[model samples]
Target: MKRYDPALYAILALIFALSCAYVPLAGRGGGEMTIEVVRDGKTEFRAPLGDVPEMLEFRGPEGYNAISSVEGVRMVSADCPGGDCIRAGTIKNAGESIICLPHRLTVKLTKESASEMDAVSY
Candidate 1:
């Protein structure tokens, strides 16, 4: 077998680190964002995230959830056994989501369109 140099491993490690760091940033963008509530693959609620009512309630298979859509979207409270969904925190970025497995519920943020500033003028 041919012997390999340590430099090769170091280069691979650097590439992996940079790619992992960029993956999260790639999911974020400046645009008009909306909150989508999906239950069992069906869209139940969809609205501008920041413009939604201060408090919204949803009934799921497991129980109920109180959602807050102030500046961002979040599950303020839920009747599920585990409070993981509520602990998922606010989702202000496009492509972010909170899933409640037991309740078969998902709250996601979607970008309606890329902001004009993201375009380059010739």
Candidate 2:
């Protein structure tokens, strides 16, 4: 039998701990979702997806883009070619997005967790 190296085991354990530390625990419940509007590669506006319906307008490079949200989020009006953004009906979940290439604009839904994890462990 070969002898076990203490240093190797210690390193393996540390790696495992660090890897699991960032894993979000399940059953934490759903978080609030928000719509982030990006223009010119920068976030220009953000709004919460709540009960009351809302309409937002943002000035893009070419013109203006209008977004509406009630139960979910959607781009209601825009001058972008094909009006694809308007076709992206509604998104209620995290990681969903809508983009308009002509206007160089993007709308995304992001979940804001109550207990957010840190990027690094010190």
Candidate 3:
């Protein structure tokens, strides 16, 4: 029969606690942005934009699509089955987006910028 060592268990528990403590520090100074598509006040699609084109092709299963740029964001396509989202074209701004009535999807862009000092905590 094999016996478990209490010291080993304690060390493993300590390691897990340290890792959990560090999780919040991972986001110290890095900014994150989420683009959400909504219709009738319901969220449909969300995307992160490092560039304009990457945001253009973001799509969700519920017939939602979104695109974004430094200036704005919009919906370029959707799978609402009526193709209304496709006609909306592109939008480049913070609060700009396109919605499809049939599919009940909306696309919007959000940005988050954190100060560099936050990194020091990590």
Candidate number achieving the greatest TM-score relative to the actual structure: 1
Q: What TM-score would each prediction reach against the true structure?
A: 0.64, 0.63, 0.40
Across 50-91, the per-residue lDDT of candidate 2 in tens digits comes to: 743588888855887888786678888998778888887888
Residue-level lDDT tens digits of model 1 in 25-120: 675666777889999999999987767889989986579988888777788989888889999998877778888878899898888443324432
Per-candidate Cα lDDT values, in order, are: 0.82, 0.78, 0.58
Q: How big is the positional error of residue 56 in model 2, measured in Å on the Cα after superposition?
A: 0.4
Taking the tens digit of each residue's C-alpha lDDT, what string does model 3 give over 23-93? 87665554555567565686644556553355455344454544444455545555567776667766654
Once fitted onto the true fold, the runs of candidate 3 whose alpha carbons sit more than 4 angstroms away are 1-33, 44-47, 51-77, 111-122
Indicate the worst ten consecutive residues by lDDT in candidate 1. 113-122
lDDT of 2: 0.78
Task: Note the residue pairs that clash in candidate 2.
Answer: none
- The local lDDT score (0 to 100) that residue 74 gets in candidate 1 is 85
Clashes of 2: 0
Candidate 3, pairs of clashing residues: 37-106, 37-107, 38-106, 71-93, 72-92, 72-93, 73-93
